[model samples]
Target: MKTTGTVPRLTARGVATRARIVEAAADLVFERGVAETGLDAVLAASGTSKSQLYHYFADKDDLVLAVIERQTERVLAEQEPQLHELDSIAGLHRWRDALVGLQRHGGCVGGCPIGSLVAELAGSDRPRELLRAGFARWESFLVAGLTTMRDRDELRPDADPRDLATAVMTALQGGLLLTATTRSTRPLELGLDMAIAHVEAHRLSRSVQPRGRREGPVDAGPARPAGTSTASRSG
Candidate 1:
């Protein structure tokens, strides 16, 4: 609840202390889950006293919110590169490949950091909204890139970036959940492939395609095993 902008600025050491508490809480929740991770556990893990924890967070829920915010920032930062490259079919394929690779690298152990939170926090209105906002922010990145593609006439005028981005985001979250549950990257790969294909389906006809646009069906890239460390903690 004590956002940086909402509260008085903390000294450098105070900022680090607050961050340590949030990081510790996030780790504990990731390991034992939200319901099992108590404030005492957070205090023990963070090496901070009750007063220190309460000084920053109003309660357990407040601390959890901070953890969610931290995880959201981390997730977005990890995916920013690929998210920015979704302006074309080729770029989208490359982004999809990157996500699948990351899942394989981590052996599909963790579902998306933010997505996993949804399952645990859905009943809690405040946390649920926070998680929703996180997903929306993630979708916005795709929306921006897809908008660029539409602007360039690569996609049909009727192709709504918001809708396309939502489809892609939904596919990603569902795929990640399945991949983590099955300990295989197949679901993630398939989800992204189909999502990209959906986008490609909206492409302009070859006859009307712009001069610089690449011709032919979008290549699915070489058949290879998935592997990437970028989002290892994201799952």
Candidate 2:
């Protein structure tokens, strides 16, 4: 989160080295809370020296920002191709299922890596902003999907995509926190299920014929906000 004038240019090898260090830092921080993971631990885990770390990062906090960025990318990565295509109810369901699968795969131990980081660093302005930015990126995808549903008349004209997107994100976050606390994915599952069901009312009847049989790609409705599908817009 510390800023130093213009960004420094790095060669291919330097970029790789910095990436290796960031990856190590992200792993350590995810496994153990950020406070517990120190420069020494990062160095040991990353197999890098003090000079090498300092060359790329200003300090522990600076490195942590990098780790945050890394973890954010990982979170988005897990939701990939589905995350990119979340413009309909069916897409939302797919995204929800994929998220639940991630928790189940981990036995629900980590409790939303980015969410936990936000809770721990809430007091720090830079960390908090970065965290918020990451969540915003995630939220934007929902907004897009929901907006399309509305545009396609798949959702009620009165429904608000932005608001619904925020609600869905809140549900997922709350559920993840509870899941982490309870060590069960049920809370998260239920939360997502309810959130998805909330959208059922807004969906066009034709899309839900016979109940639960609806399965298809979300129609590409209306023009999208430029770059909504890209990483830049996400941040």
Candidate 3:
């Protein structure tokens, strides 16, 4: 969970170099795909010589794993604050709209980078393991946000935050896959709406009491604060 900028000075430059290589590799892989991308291409894109490249990444596979980790951090960084603010229906709606907007704006060219890695590495143990770890970390972040909602009574008392987080993660990955294959955003939009509906349906509601004139009971759900969607806001 350490920020990339706070690494100790002893190997700061080396860490920065490695990060640059990973970033370059991720961008290339996303643009050209794994099958077409090569180590030489990554080296050229990163502006790192062969020795430096080898020093940072032992091989193409190692670089690919590093790219996966880099993408994981990038995705989480983009999502954190907004996802953490999902304690109200309005906030959740913003989150969903942001996701839809991202795909629409990107021309649906880029789905989830982690999901792309998983597809490229299907049946490969090493890559699969790396992907599993990345997804586990991502799911943990979502679960933390859901737990916050539960604590604020925004979610039903008996709701399983972990399960809800996992379901959301599953739907996102599946939706991304469908979007990539069909070159359409409909599936992603529909899947996200269903996910939001599920979350809203299980949202906690409180009994409200009327004031001076008359006494009546009212249903009060979570209150919304000024919030923005991370996905829609991302570049």
Candidate 4:
């Protein structure tokens, strides 16, 4: 969208070449950051010449937009199943466990694919808007699950799905940042745990505990004598 003009239509081979360029750029940007990654590196990694790269992308900015879109797609694809199943508190915990497991497996190397991009590109309007849209898409999944839970009487009527979703997103991003910085999953676990705890605090009934948690047998105070009224007992 800058000095390089718009991308032209491409044949099948052209499409594949363009995809290679974008994927390579995405990987480079993910590893070295947007500033450190250059078109020369992308070309080398993708095995495409400069002319071919320019044929599909207007400029480095255009390539970056493609990278953001690709990363967004990759992330959402990975999260779609768990995000869709978030209607129950147990399901939320399951999703959290999956996320922690992922970080643990990766040793928390990358904070978040999209989050890293956002951190670098937020100063720019177009990239920021694109990243914001990507985040919105992710948040929508959470909102849908929370809305369903609220409608099903699992959550308090006052619980706002959007607000809770925002809280969860904030916790997740923060956790991922800390996890990557520290190379440990503890921060991520705590973040998700606190977020879920916040959600649980808004449950419709505290008497009914979520799965995997046990409540001690209720001590219903001393039983009242055989149908005796409080007035008679006081007298």
In candidate 1, which residue pairs get closer than 3 Å at backbone N, Cα or C atoms, i.e. clash? 101-227, 101-228, 110-235, 111-235
Error of 1 at 64 (Å): 0.7
Predicted structure 4, TM vs. truth: 0.85
lDDT of 4 by residue, 76-134 (tens): 88776797898876678778877877766766788899998887899999899889988
Off by over 4 Å in 4: 1-6, 206-235
What is the C-alpha local distance difference test score of candidate 4? 0.79
Question: Which TM-score value belongs to model 2?
Answer: 0.84
For model 2, how does the per-residue alpha-carbon lDDT over 9-36 read when each residue is reduced to its tens digit? 8899887888889999999899898998
What clash pairs does model 2 have?
87-145
Off by over 4 Å in 3: 1-13, 205-235
The best candidate in terms of TM-score: 1
* lDDT tens per residue, model 3, 67-100: 7778887777867666665655556566666666
Instruction: Give each model's whole-structure lDDT.
Output: 0.80, 0.77, 0.70, 0.79
Misplaced by over 4 Å in model 2 are 1-7, 204-235
Cα RMSDs of all predictions?
Answer: 4.1, 9.0, 6.8, 12.1
**Where does candidate 1 stray beyond 4 Å?**
1-9, 207-235
Residue 192 CA displacement from its true place in model 3, Å: 0.8
